[model samples]
Target: MMTKHELRREYLDRRRALTDIEVQESSLQIANKVLELDIWSFSNYHVFLPIQKQKEINTQYLLHILQGKDKNIVVSKSNFEDISMSHYLLTDQTKLRINSHGIPEPDQNGIPIDEKNIDVVFVPLVIADRFGNRVGYGKGFYDRFLKKCRPDVIKIGLSMFEPLESKIDMHVNDVGLNYILYGEEVIDLG
Candidate 1:
């Protein structure tokens, strides 16, 4: 099995190799797939803004769709000092600033959204396996934040490519996803 570090490097290069047009189109496809889900059933949603440098799935498209539906679009603010992440409602007036890692995060300390209120979480990943195990940049930010979420909250990973057939090197601290929105398909691990 490939290690998480190896998978991260391998998939990050593949993502970076895609043309801008391909990225946008693939992102749209994945976004459209999730739109057909029972998304409206969830009132509060947690989502991530894209990191342009990595060419991640443009979840901005997903966010807009969720926004128009009047779902509570929640983004995050990462604090390296505490090795923790805080969730906030993304609004038109909320300022988004790119961090040192290039991930767009909400700037102002807006009202913190409670974990219990979040019914769904849209995760960004470097790659994932069919079993819903995934690799990000090796930062445990999402993993730590997710552990605190309600046990029944749906955690969905959005990826530009299909999942590898093999399982990932999952750690005890890692949080498994319930579904992966991969390359225009919604894969349910359960």
Candidate 2:
């Protein structure tokens, strides 16, 4: 089995190789797949804005869906110093700017939403396995952020490709995802 580091590098290369059209189309498909989930009854939904340069999933489509559903959307601003993220409510007046790392974040803090209030989180990842083990950018930002959320918080990973047949390495501190959305498939890990 490939290590998490190896899987991260491999999947990063694969994602970078995707064309812009592929990314957008796959992201839309994944977003549509999310509709099948029973998570719509939640209020505060935390989602990650994609890192465009890395060819990550275009979460803009998913954001549109959330907006249409009238759910309270929450986005995060990352603190590189502590490797932690501060959650904020994304409002119509919230201005977004790309940070130094190419992540689109709120230019200024909006309504602060505590992690415990988040009912569902749309997590970003390089790749994930059948068991919901994910390989991200090695930042541990989401793991740390998710750790602080309520134990019942729904954690969903968005991916373009299907999960790997083999499980990736897992750490004691790593938080597993509840489900993974890829293409038109939803892999339920719970």
Candidate 3:
């Protein structure tokens, strides 16, 4: 088995090879397509913006609509890479921070979560399988968070590439995605 360090390195290397223009164009296209979907138009959604060096999407624009700030504006927070959870209420001002391990802990004011209110959640992944299994940074933060969330919550995995057919070792606690969105396609995991 590869060490965690090696796995991380390989993941980072592959991610870094993607150029800025390519990442931007692909992410924008995917985000646009998602917005055009009926599900996005009809539901309350929470999206997690990626950190630097990872594929960056135009989350701020989406946030504006969800937060009711402006239809055409995109808002992003500072100190994003250091912020835990990177969790902010799409409908409120509250932010939840995530630690280095990817575990989200409510901030001092507590995370304002409306369990039944959330319709969709966009997640980040290093890699994913056709079976809906995702290999995150290996920290299990998203996995743990998903466990505490409502089962009906739509779990969407956002990736820059298509799903890999190879087996990715997953534990029992690992969360499965309901949908996987890639630059090339959007797959329904149901």
Candidate 2 residues 1-190, lDDT tens each?
7888888889899998999999989999998999999998899999899999999999888889999999999999999999999989999999999999999998655889999999999999999989998999998999999999999999999987899888788999999999999996999888
lDDT of 3 by residue, 147-181 (tens): 65678878878777777776566778788998887
Q: Rank candidates by TM-score, best first.
A: 2, 1, 3
Model 1, 77-164: lDDT tens digits are: 8888877888899888898889998979887668789877899999989998889898988879999988889999899999888998
Select the stronger candidate by lDDT from 1 and 2.
Answer: 2
- Best candidate per TM-score, number? 2
Worst 10 residues of 1 by lDDT: 34-43
Where model 1 places Cα greater than 4 Å from the true spot, the runs are none
Model 2 CA lDDT for position 112: 90
Cα deviation of 64, candidate 2, in Å: 1.1
For every model shown, what is its TM-score relative to the native structure?
0.96, 0.98, 0.71
Local distance difference test values of all predictions, in order: 0.88, 0.92, 0.62
Q: How far out, in Å, is residue 50 in model 3?
A: 1.6
Looking at model 3, report the run of 10 residues with the lowest lDDT sum. 69-78
